[model samples]
Target: MRIKNSTVVITGADSGIGRATALRFAKKGARVVLASRDAAALETLAADCRRRGAKALAVQTDVADPEAVEELCESAVGNFGRIDIWVNNAGTGVFGPFLDTPLEDIQRVVDVDLMGVVHGAREALEQMRAQGEGVLINVASMAGIIPQPYTSAYSMSKAAVRALGVSLRSELRLARVKDIHVVTVSPGAVDTPFFDHVANYTGQDTRPIPPTYSPDKIAAAIVNVARSPQRELTVGLIPKAMVAKHKLFPQAVERRMATLTHRKHLKATQPAPPTKGNLDRAAGDDATGRRGRKTGGHGGRTKTMARRLLVIGGAAGVTAFAAFRWRQ
Candidate 1:
């Protein structure tokens, strides 16, 4: 649909990908509603959007609270008449081994990442079904598909997120609601505050894996999808290839991931204490904007240390998978 004068609501709008997506849409003449637990930051972002000539409202909302999310939807419509696009971007993570991670932390991750998407989608779909047209964009991660070993909760949440979109699409089609579109975007490791805010138990400061892409690129893809919605999108090139390889050689890839891929998941930098970073509370004062501080983490290829030996030993196992055959 056309962007100008459209009404859009974005959750988790205070920082990171949500903020970037809000700004991108606002610049296109869309009235934007900002939602997150950080009211101060949302106010700042609303002012920024207003300066860009878009009608803006800041509504502090915690997606985990069903009532708060419903209130968010009412506030958006009360201020702006109708909802044309809803971006379900509010999310948090826990980066630790399952056994070591606290149960509360795991539950919070599900509440924010998976259930949060469910709430946004439900509210948006209700509004959209009434109007007979709307767009819903859910931001899932590459971890959902590839499956990271350490961050089990986050991986499960994201995977369920993908499933949610697929099921929603099927249900909508069955009901003949073709105008309402549900799009799922799977992004690669992104340069966002997520790594900084994740509940870490790995004993070392966590960082996004190598081949990180900017949040702005993701925001752009989301805006594009709003105009021309597709079934699913894998944002970055490296992530696309990774997904392909994993599908072609599941056992081999699982073995590779299980092997010492510490560099792939984290940096050998300073250690951080075990804390529920942003799972329960809003990230304090520093959560106002998109784009996070660059990490000095892995910047090169995730080349195996013993590349020759692994490839040679697994040659027969992977020979059937010609497309995924690894080479030196």
Candidate 2:
């Protein structure tokens, strides 16, 4: 589909992948509607888009809310006359042992990361069916394909998103809606404020940030998907390899992950102060008043040790697999 002159609605547009995508689309000559719970940030992004000579609107929306999503769709169609693309990019993460993680945190993550995508797709489909031409882009993650230790809830949510995309794509085809496209983009670790916002179950005062790719890298992939719809697009070499390895050698991957697991780190006994400066708070969604305050927990020597071991192990596994594939 041609991106020029199309009207697109992007959730989580306050920052990160969503914000980058909004800017990219606007720069590509598409009218963009930036939606997120953060009114101020949304306004700033929209203004930036306008500065780039593109028509833009900021809609303060909590995608987890069904009514809010409907309103978002209405506002976009009302203002722009049609909806061409709907991007479900708003998401959050919580890390720690599944048993130790707060139920509230789990529910929140599922609601935002999974149900939020569902709501966006439902609203987009309703409008797109009428127009007979639209694109639904769901932003998943590498975790969706290969579940990681200590991030069970996030992994589950992303896996569900991948399933949702596949199901929706087939349903759309069966319904004979050739113009309505459903695409999923799975990105690896990205340089976003995601780590800052992540709920920690380990009770650590601060969480360690992982190696990351730029948000612009994923944004470029999303633009490509919109232009030429695909079933799925995996971002990053490591993540792509992990997905392929999991498919080809599930047992080997499972053995490696288990061997790399940090059992000692899982026992974070001392609760430190909670962390602060998460993107959620930055976006002004600190409704719980927990913004800018540490959540709690001291650093765990064992946890750090475990992370290092996993990194080394993962690298070794990837190298071995790559060599084998090259030889083949």
Candidate 3:
């Protein structure tokens, strides 16, 4: 579908991937509606989009609240006349041993990460079904596929999101809703404020896993998917290969991922106190001491790590395919 003049709504638009995606859509001449718990930030983003010559509206929303999400949809239609694309990008996470993590924090993660997607998708689908044509993009994560040991809640919520996309597609197919589409995007570790805003109980500082791609990269993927919808998309090359490997060797890959997450995802040397980071409310600039920093939690080895992962993934993909063919 053409993006120019398309009406698009993006949640979690205050910063990170959502923020980037909103800007990309704006640049493409799409009418954009920005949603987030941070009203001021959303207004700023809306102004930025308008400056770029796109119609934009800032709606302060907590995606966990179904009513608020419903209002968000109404606002979009009232302003733009129709909904063409809805990106369910609002999410939060918790990182700690399941037993050590606070129960409330676990619930909050589900509320924001899982239920938030649920609310956005539900509201958007209803609007799309009425219009008979639209796209719904749900942002899941690699953790949903390869299991992270410490972040049980976060992983579970993301896994559920992946399942939700599958179920929605099946339902749409059965109903012969050909024009309406549901797309799931599973992104690899990304350079976003997510690590900084995560609820951490590990008694250590958190960081994104290696080979972290910039939020802009993921934003581009989301925008591309909106133009040409697909049932599912693994955004990064490394994540795509790891997903394939997991399909062939779930147990081995799961074990290796668990080990890597322990060694690299969390920084034991950098001790930090536990806090409920952005799970319940919007953790604005003051949440992390670096007030204006939007991304860059990962180290500076992104390009190098990506190259290494690509080589390893290519070799693994060839070997795996060859082995399967030999058995057949």
- The runs of at least 3 residues in candidate 1 whose Cα sits more than 4 Å from the true structure, single-residue gaps closed, are 258-261, 297-328
Give the number of colliding residue pairs in candidate 3. 0
Estimate every model's Cα lDDT from 0 to 1: 0.85, 0.78, 0.86
Error of 3 at 257 (Å): 0.8
**Clash count list over all predictions:** 0, 12, 0
- TM-score, one value per model: 0.89, 0.82, 0.93
RMSD of each: 5.1, 6.3, 2.5
Clashing pairs in 3: none
Worst 10 residues of 2 by lDDT: 287-296
Higher-lDDT candidate of 1 and 2: 1
Model 1 is weakest, by summed lDDT over 10 consecutive residues, at 295-304
Q: Can you write out model 2's per-residue Cα lDDT over 70-186, one digit (the tens) per residue?
A: 999999999999999999999987767688777877887888899999999999998999999888999998878877777788889999999999999999888877888999999
How well does candidate 2 match the true structure in TM-score terms?
0.82
lDDT tens readout by residue for model 1, 61-169: 9999899999999999998899999999999988787799999999999999999999999999999999999999999988788778778998899999999999999
Error of 1 at 103 (Å): 0.3
What's the lDDT for residue 210 in model 1?
Answer: 60
